[model samples]
Target: MSTRLPALITHLAHRHVSVPGLLHSGFGGTEIDQAHRDVLDHLAHAVTAERHRVDEAAQTVMRGATTVIQALSHQMRSKIDEMQHRYDDPGLAQHLLGLDHLNEQNLRHIQGTGVLCGAWPGLTHADSHLGDIVAGAQSRIRGYHRVQVTSQMEAPVAVVARAVEPIAITVAELLANALHHTHGTLAIDVSLHQAESGACVVIDDAGVGMHSDETEFASRLLSGQRTILLTELGDPPRTGFAKISRLMRQYGFSVSIDKSSPYGGVRAVVFIPGNLLTLLDEHTHPMSAMAPLPRPTSPTRTGTLPTGDAGGTGGTGEGLPRRRRRDAQPAGHLPAARPDQAPTPEETQATWSAFQAGTASGRAASRTDHLEGNH
Candidate 1:
């Protein structure tokens, strides 16, 4: 009877261990096992609920941090704008421009964080030309000079007011990624193509292309099929693709980065559907009436300098008067000036002087307009 009792206890112990496996495999067992499975299911659900709560808490903390940074950046930018106005010396003007550019890059990072936390792009502008939108994006990054934009639209294409900022942010992130991966003075080619269905902004780089796995991961992220946590972004946190994904899902546009570039690098294409597009004249607002676009500046080395840096010469070097002409050119076509006929130094200096004068005049006009509007 003692031996039989020991065997019975061992049988009961083995049955208890099998309950969890039965629950996992969705199998039914003895009534006692079923009761054990019910308890285990409840515990599992509790754990999942706790994990969700923690994720929400972490996102809340990140959103709060981004909000604080954004407010500080706005005040700093206002001060920089005032300084830009107070100074007329070319060298000082250049330095002020660099500061402004740096602030813009900082703002991009902050805005990206906010967006990933389910916040809007935060600035609203009147409907704007697609070319201008692309140029506006080009002005935001560290390697603006390396970007060569060519537009092939038969007519002007403008983004609807609702989509303007989100598209610009996506393009800027793409340009930054291209700049980070490419080396030397190789040009990053950005081409705009318009079709009956929509308009596409195609960015091609000259760096080594992504591996199959990297491409697959990027495809999944851009598709917005998977939920991403900030913790999953890896050390130092790359929020670019994640931010782009959020914007893509929220807005109706789509992005594809799965293709290879002719330049032996990755090719990324952003397509804005016809529903989100308009003519330049449609729903247009006065420049002063709309949220001000980022003022064009001479490209300076802002943000982390990617490996194989291009000497950051897209515009005048750091601490130089802002040159709006180079970047402000319409994205639809290349400059008419022949490459062989480079402007003489005297001609270049004259152009710079004219640019500075125009900038001052424009500011004065804007102030006057504001006063008149108030009256």
Candidate 2:
């Protein structure tokens, strides 16, 4: 036994480390503990590093996807417009007009998509009026005619160059929600108020007011206190509020749903601090003059459908209940957006419906990939 013990010790100490190295060697108990800790530290750092890489890759993919969608959306819109103008058939032209509206709605969705991914490649520095921004938002929403934008800005108030599109997108989300919830033709009022602290975009709707949990959710989003995840947005994902929340966080803004409108509906207030504003330069033409907003030729109907409402009666122009609920948005995570050019009329008349429906599979298939985690 004695001989065996010496032999065992000799074998164990065959590669014995020097005294200084023993403190870090794998053989010593303390050294073994330290080695384990070192390995853990390395693993932690590797995980952190990998997470950053994944995040960066995701952003890149999102940015690219937004760019492509904007392009397709713009092209289709232009085709619809040109077909409307050149063709003499009023009936066919009307159909084209409908397609054009869908294109605009899709554009709005894409813009929101861009907002989520932090990719706004559009006009960044514009000397834009508060009304111009409101108009832009109104133009993007489905029921633009139903939204009345009133500005009490005494001076020629401008959204600073960096803030123009982000402000527009934020306003669009607020306006879109307001329009979505109300009776098909029920009017929404968006009033703009500017003060020293910041600018305010107040949206009042006549739809059913929000529940407490919904209100809390909206508040969290608008304040950017919560981070958005794809899983949280519900299946088929209503990305509108989530999109605006990201922009609000990035752009140094705040939105709240704490107030009730005079019409017994939801009142959403978007607070844009003074840093986002600039006095309109005399040389600037704020309005882009793309096209006039369309009036609602059809009567305002009840049962208005939301964009992604697949349940109940399917998300159509009509089917949503009049008392549709409103959601909230938060913090300023705004990305500057530059949308692609819009459609020509021919594309709207003949080809748009098919393209819109997913007949064009190549690009459409990738849409999910780009927006997978974006919601």
Candidate 3:
């Protein structure tokens, strides 16, 4: 029954040998007989339990499969009917005929029943839910203007409950940053992979490249720096990169910011390794492993970030004492910013004036890139 009962019986035999040492005065043959009987009884119970568990699991799987197959069968028939009669025009007949053939093929596959994976319906539903969350983000950013935009996605998508939500938030943050920082068009690339070892999600955006120093500063957020004042501009809705960086840390992922392309501004990539999503086993190798695995205390921006090296004076702004500013810019410098909004600032009287004056737009852009200071 669990394939281990025989081994268990062998173990009990070893224990039976010990019985004689504890009961020296007992009749040797009778003692052996009782111990043998006890072991046999336990072995029987264990086998029965394993078999029952196996049977129950098999029945549940069959029930789920049947339900999905039946639903698929009905859906396929409806599709066939719709395709066969929806178009009456002679010119469209060829296309309709092809669709009908495809529909029939699908119907056959469903009716085969064997086509469904062992626990297909449940898996399908789970995948569908993840697809929706992913699609929703795509939909929200669909119409945002871009200098250039492109995307790629790969799958067997590890959609774990523990890290999924945090990763989603991190993705939204990076996507928004791409839209806000890039000039004309932006390109986005996303990859999700599950291997013999683990899983990973990689997102890349081509837009405005960030200064090597500043990008490193943001990335090292989790390593040695705990809390970062997100914006020079005042509080709440005005959250800057620091907040996003912290959130990524909460789930054991790190953010790397670099130039989007050979040409320009900033690119932020969020890397979630497989083990953080779940516990690893004997076979789990990291699919998206980073070399010199970062220590939780190491500055995030140390090596991969444009920020200065870990020992260099430049990147570790996190360790320096923050200079108090009595006349610093008020937190309300940009009132419309939010944790997930595209990096775009709301059109305000000041922004319009700057755009029209020409010089102001350049200066405003400069101030944005210098977010963490030229240091």
Candidate 4:
């Protein structure tokens, strides 16, 4: 028997109050009574039944739709690849091949959804370096060219096989979020740091950051119990953060956003607990401190910060200089290319050529002054 039951009943009896209406009737109960227990039990059972029905229907429909979408994305990618190979004009081929990359992104999104909704297959992998996973994720983002990767993780250390891709996927989603929200011209810095125990991957972007309330909501979503229903998502759905949240819960990692960034933008930090990491080389000592990788060229050709007011077109600036793009013409003729913007024929050709030739390695902008962008 509940210890408080007799007291609660006695108190309610003295007050001449019905327990069922205690809450809505504006008379709060200090203890639990039989009526309260019965009411809570009945509501719990009803909610459980309703929740099961809703989850079943949502999963069935979403899984079916995403599967169809996945099939189409694959077919589209094959045709785009074929077209890229056939075209002699570099510009035309570039235009056609851009579709292929977008298709791949779509496929990843669907697979992420499948993982979330309980349709995707089990995670599979062999041991891979944390740096390699970071590279894989950077390669998948839309504005990969604008991202700079700095890793102290060197070749000798590796994430345990089981945690590699999930970590990669979570990092990619964070990068995608940064790129999507910022002007494509801005630099996004992704850095890797090794803890004495685990590791951390931090992504900093020069995008409009989220509000406090938004952060709270996102925090709850990321760290909450895995009891969410599909219906709770928005109409078209926003699965980027949600997808990562699910993975973090399942795979034993932690994620936090906008903790620290020099650019006044969003900073996403992923904490990989020590349990998920291992040293690949038996002889080589894993560095407790980070070592810098080769830095990539800045946004400007001259590597001088562009001339603009702090609060002007782009955003914040502390006056660290960077050169302008060599290829960019006047502001009239030169439209700023963004990740979400459809690529022009010429731009596509240039990017595709870089990808094909394998000389297109981009760096993450880890420096603090590079945080702000030029208009």
Candidate 5:
């Protein structure tokens, strides 16, 4: 029996372990305790072995991800170099203009598919197109205009694409505004830094800066103000500022406009949340094997149809009562709105209609146009 017990333990240890089954045998007090101890030791060793295996697998996965990203970056850099060298070619400008169309197609695809993994390729392609455009534009607009750029933290291709697209758009708008509104030498200084909260990208322009009050108003509008103030200067036109504001809001980032700048121009500070940077970082360390958090569900909308009448109950037909009867309700319970501020049926209908009209108009005009040809 003694000899058989060792053999049994050895066999069970090599095979699948069942601690309870191992302890269940004809044995005395000491033997029973020893068997229990052996079972526990086997389990601990198995757990350690499994954990080591998992760690090695994770490391391998991470190495693979790093390799893929490095290769993608190398290819992009090589292509950009080739394009830079071809800049002087007589037909280079025309070819880049053609690539601009391809850039638009890639952007549209990214929007439709929501495939962020393809972001670098799409962005690098678009960057090449823009680089050509910038070169062409510079030849004509090159006077005393100043441009400075600084960046920190290795930017992943995907991050570069997502970050640069909106920035370029905003900068283009600013440049156009400066060219038309301001005179004399214009300069732009851009800096990117990593903060404890997140990454911050600042752009400063030495053009005719906005007035103090106007800058404050613009700052407020950028910080989640849906309705912009139309100043006594008359309608400011929604061509540039309004569009920039809308895009910034959609991206869940904060944009601030300040009257102060070293160059005596308007300063724009864009705070990029670390989440996007983290996504790029994860791509660098994909072997973690930990699943990312699910995206939060967007808020549900009350799709109430527009209807007339001040306080009639049947408007929109979903049985949402227009009035809250205090007597019919439980004591101390309150409705979401105060009795005075509660929107009247007419007001609600008018507001909803306006919103719907604006939404339709925005969608129709949102198709991005990359203006070609030098000014």
Candidate 6:
């Protein structure tokens, strides 16, 4: 009887350790009863079911909160747009632009939260150029000036209407992650490449790369193979990868961060399948496109910041176009320029004016479309 008693206690101890795990992993009460019918198994099953219920309730709350935030953000953006048009003062306009940028970032956060909580990315009825989408995503983040984009596609590629916002959100999250991990002055390189089966937006940063374990975890999250719970995300929870995973499951695109960058950082690639791609006719006008913030008007190469008084042409250093610091010259001195080798200030001013005019036209067209749709 003593030997049998020892064996029985050991068996109970094993069950004690394993039952909670199995129940938490979704083992039903009936399944547990079939294996070992006992009061402990029943209690564990009830506890796990309650825990799942609480998680669902929390997710619903999160979704509702994000929905409210998103609506508010949209209203704020519309007001800002109105103010931008009402004020002609360059100084005030610059401040408004900065405010608009911040509001965009806020909207991104809210959208990401909504996605993680099972809400869809906001609806868009018009298709957007893929390059413009990436540019728009870059503008949504804080380090927009530090990103250098190089597009290598032979022709313009546009994302379908339904997938536009999801792709933008995913790229923005990846860019934000890259920017967050990197330190000051390091540029993020974004290159768009055409793949045989689809197109890829590749982002690379010079920040410290992820460890193997971290990479593996991110891969699992991005793969959508494992279910993710908001409770599992740490304090000030990181929902970027999880949001990307959810979007991938809903949308048809795929993202990968397992590759290392040439800059010794992370190389994140977002591949949009051919089914989601449509060719943009050269003569077609943009439709409800999200315009990228105007880049600093400075004579500098990609990934390099401009130096002294980069406000372009006759512009004062008092607005969003103002550039603060100068970059060092390259090693070899250039030969003296021919008479018309570089663009004259007048020419630069004309180019800048054209760009502004085009942006205003796009905005006006978008507003007209919105009004027409309402009718």
Considering every candidate listed, which one attains the maximal TM-score? 6
Residues 1-375 of candidate 6: C-alpha lDDT, one tens digit per residue: 334333434444243432222324455566664564464456556655666788789888888787777777877877887886676665565566668779989989987988898886654635666777787677678867667666555435567777887898999999999988877567787777666667789998878888887787698798788677776666788788999999999988999995578777889999998778665443454422223222234453232111122213222223222322223223222112123344445554443344344334323322212211121
Give the distance in Å from residue 105's predicted Cα in candidate 5 to where it truly belongs. Answer: 17
Please give the distance, in angstroms, between residue 236's alpha carbon in candidate 4 and its true position after superposition: 4.7
Give the per-residue lDDT digits (tens) of candidate 4, residues 243-341.
Answer: 888888788999997646766788899988767765443223221111133223344333212222211213222232222222212221212345467
Clash count for each candidate, listed in order shown: 3, 39, 21, 13, 1, 1
| Model 2 CA deviation exceeding 4 Å by range | 1-63, 80-96, 121-125, 281-375
lDDT values for all models: 0.65, 0.58, 0.38, 0.60, 0.39, 0.65
- Please give each candidate's TM-score: 0.68, 0.58, 0.34, 0.64, 0.36, 0.69
Clash pairs, candidate 5, are 62-287
Which candidate, 2 or 6, would have the higher TM-score against the true structure? 6
**Candidate 5 to truth, TM:** 0.36
TM-score of candidate 1 to 2 decimals:
0.68
Give the alpha carbon lDDT tens digit for every residue of 43-160 in model 1: 5566556656777788877776776676677678668768766765666665666677788799888878878887666666656667777876776788665787766554345677
Largest lDDT belongs to which candidate? Answer: 6
Residue 306, candidate 5: alpha-carbon lDDT: 24
Please give the TM-score that candidate 2 achieves against the real structure. 0.58
In model 1, where do residues sit more than 4 Å from their true spots? 1-44, 282-375
lDDT of 2 by residue, 1-375 (tens): 333334433443232422123333456567566665575456556655665566567766767787677777867865665675577564586476677767778887876777676665243444455666676567666766567555544334456656666777778888887766777646777776656566688888877877887776676666677556544566677777788788777778777775578767789888877666555332333223321221122354332211232222333434222221122122211112222433466654443343233222212212322232332
**lDDT accuracy of residue 57 in candidate 3:** 67
- Per-residue lDDT of 1-375 in model 3, one digit per residue for the tens? 233345554554333332222234364568675675576577768865665566456645544555555455445545644553464454454444345445434433332222121222111111111222233233224222221121122221233444544454455556656665654433444433333333334444455566666565555553536433212213433333544554554557666666654334454555655444332111222211110111122333322222122222234334432212223223212112233443322332232222223221111221111111111
Candidate 2 lDDT score at position 18: 20
The candidates, ranked best first by lDDT, are 6, 1, 4, 2, 5, 3
Superposed model 5: Cα runs more than 4 Å off: 1-146, 152-164, 175-184, 228-238, 279-375
